[model samples]
Target: MQKVFFISDHHFGHKNIIDFESRPFKEVDEMTTEMIAKWNSVVGENDKVFHLGDFSFLNKEKTKAIVDKLNGYKILILGNHDRGRSRSWWLDVGFNEVSEYPIIYNNFFFLSHEPMYMNKHMPFVNVHGHIHGQKYEGKNYFNVCVEHWDYTPLTFEQIRDSVVVSEEQ
Candidate 1:
């Protein structure tokens, strides 16, 4: 069986976001290249990747070209950018999206995306990346930053063991 990973919000080619966040890439090509390289470094060809949406910048062809070079099965969770990207004729080359996934682990069901309005009350931990380091001042939740295209997914075990628990009022 192949390994699985998850990532989200890699808004490539958006110079405005890059400038504001001080992204290392000077251009889209550079960002895409780096992201692919980083992903390959940690993930394998048969690995599974769950992208939580906002895949790229510009047209779908531009984004698809970059993702096609990667070695893995990518599943998108469909963020706002995907609305425009779906129209891109070549967007399908890299990813597929699904509504919800119910995976059992840690004696609970791990759900993804779709803003966990009541996640705090749920028995399982909601693994997501829509929010950066914002929200939930202190919690064991993981916020994968869209620093570069180089993003990796954290597993349930990793979250259960490594995430720092925060006090919620």
Candidate 2:
């Protein structure tokens, strides 16, 4: 059986991540290379990988290049960076789907770029990214939380372990 994984907010071409965030790479090209390599290491041709949003800093070409080189079929949930482009642009690039927010995966809520605000109506876990693990304090919300961005696919058990909850859950 193939495994499904979720990740978000790589911001590949964003200088802020390279300068402020102090990412290991000095440029987006280097970053993309490492990210693609890392993702391909864990994900296989049969696996499914979900990328939330803000994948790159307007460098769709480079981003597409990196994605095309990776293993697994990549699905994209469009983020703020995807603005100003046609809806079909993502599919034309390589993404299977381009959604706005709150996509569903195995009854779980999946979001990228930013953490989707949750209410009582949803009992599903929200696996999200877009931060250095600073924005959110808990391991999970709704049900589970994924808060890292190294282009790696995580196991369900890893996500479940990071979940945090309130009394309502």
Candidate 3:
């Protein structure tokens, strides 16, 4: 069966990101290659991937090349860095769809590139990516930055289960 996955903050081709985020790889090529391999390992061609943002730091040509080799139907929610490009540009780069703002998915999940404010009174969980290694405190917020997930895409089920576990603790 096909699944839905979430991930962000790839920063592909950004050499400084290694030092900025303290990423394990020593080179951009190695980082991109490993991340692509990890992404394809869990995502299938028919699966849907919601990439919260900061997808790449490469030129349009290089970015498109990388996106073309990835698995799944990709959807991007513009991150801070991604705002420099247009929705059409992202589509041209191989994303099936691109959004300039947060979207509500499955009725109760609010998806965005940056964490959204949520109180106990709110009914939605914020599924976002940004802040790199840091995350907001609360089960209502879920960060899918590649750094937190071994550079692999995370299935929605995985995120749901984590929230459930957190609530129980």
Best by TM-score: 3
- Distance from true location, Cα of 71 in model 3, Å: 0.2
Candidate lDDT scores, in order, read 0.58, 0.64, 0.94
Give per-residue lDDT, candidate 1, residue 151.
Answer: 58
TM-score of each: 0.74, 0.79, 0.98
Q: Comparing candidate 1 with candidate 3, which one achieves the higher lDDT?
A: 3
List candidate 3 stretches off by more than 4 Å. Answer: none
lDDT of 2: 0.64
Better of 1 and 2 by lDDT: 2
Per-residue error (Å), model 2, residue 45: 0.8
Give the Å error, residue 140, model 3.
1.1
Considering lDDT, where higher is better, how would the candidates rank from best to worst? 3, 2, 1
**What tens digits encode model 1's per-residue C-alpha lDDT throughout 1-169?**
6776766677666667667667677876777677777777766778877666666676656666777777777676666655553433433655654433433334653444433544555655555555543444324344545552335554434455544434423
* lDDT, candidate 1, at 112: 47
After superposition, the stretches of candidate 1 with alpha carbons farther than 4 Å from their true spots are 87-91, 96-115, 133-135, 138-140, 148-150, 164-169
Q: Write the per-residue lDDT of candidate 3 for residues 8-64, one digit (tens) a residue.
A: 999999899999999999799999999999999999999999999999989899999
By summed lDDT, the worst window of 10 consecutive residues in model 1 runs over 97-106
Report lDDT (Cα) of residue 45, candidate 2.
Answer: 90
Clashing pairs in 1: 35-149
